[model samples]
Target: MKLERKHALVLLAIAAWNVLTYLRFIKALVDTEDRPTGYYVAHTILIVVNLLIAALLGTWGVRAYKASKASQNAQV
Candidate 1:
């Protein structure tokens, strides 16, 4: 269950991406005022979808991290 340093680093990068994407999505939603209704609707849908996907991936990464840590602890 242990992730090599390289693999862990990759997962961490993915987690960071998920976080950044979600944050940017929120910023877009907040800044979408005064735009045309069609533009706002499209952006809102895109943001919501991106947020949902990011959330799912983040949960998976967290579970993997916890499992790896648990394995390391058990070996100690």
Candidate 2:
């Protein structure tokens, strides 16, 4: 498959994981009966922020991979 196709597949997977994981996190936050102390809210927010960072890194990886492949093909 082409680099673009691979990137698209990876992006799709990441999007799916992002949506599903965020839904779970939101559910945990809203379902808590103890009225969500500060720590619990902070932790949930941290988890979300971390996942978003990971997603950004994954996007960078895809871009790097494509650029490298293009350079190699140009040299060939």
Candidate 3:
């Protein structure tokens, strides 16, 4: 499967956005100390999940970009 440059860029952007949004969520969670233990635990789990998703997207984007580049080079 040949990945296009635009698709790779979109994936990278989504990954970056996910990270940024997670940071904001963390900040909000930290700012409130009155939350229950369950609240913290749930948010922590969500944060971990989001981080994993972001990592996956970033990895996919890098791999796609590399694959596209390799294909281009091979075609030359």
lDDT (Cα, 0-100) at 14 in candidate 3: 98
Candidate 1 lDDT over residue span 4-37, tens digit each:
4456556667767877977887786787668788
Which has the better lDDT: candidate 1, or candidate 3?
A: 3
lDDT of 1 at 64: 72
Error of 2 at 75 (Å): 0.5
lDDT of 2 by residue, 6-63 (tens): 5655765776687678778777877777664886879787777867866785676577
Where does candidate 2 clash, by residue pair?
A: none
The best candidate in terms of lDDT:
3
Top candidate when judged by TM-score against the true structure: 3
TM-score comparison, 2 vs 3, better candidate: 3
lDDT of 3: 0.92
lDDT tens per residue, model 3, 1-76: 7688777888899999999999999999999888789999999999999999999999999988888788889889
- Model 3 has a clash total of 0
Q: What TM-score does each of the candidates earn?
A: 0.64, 0.53, 0.90
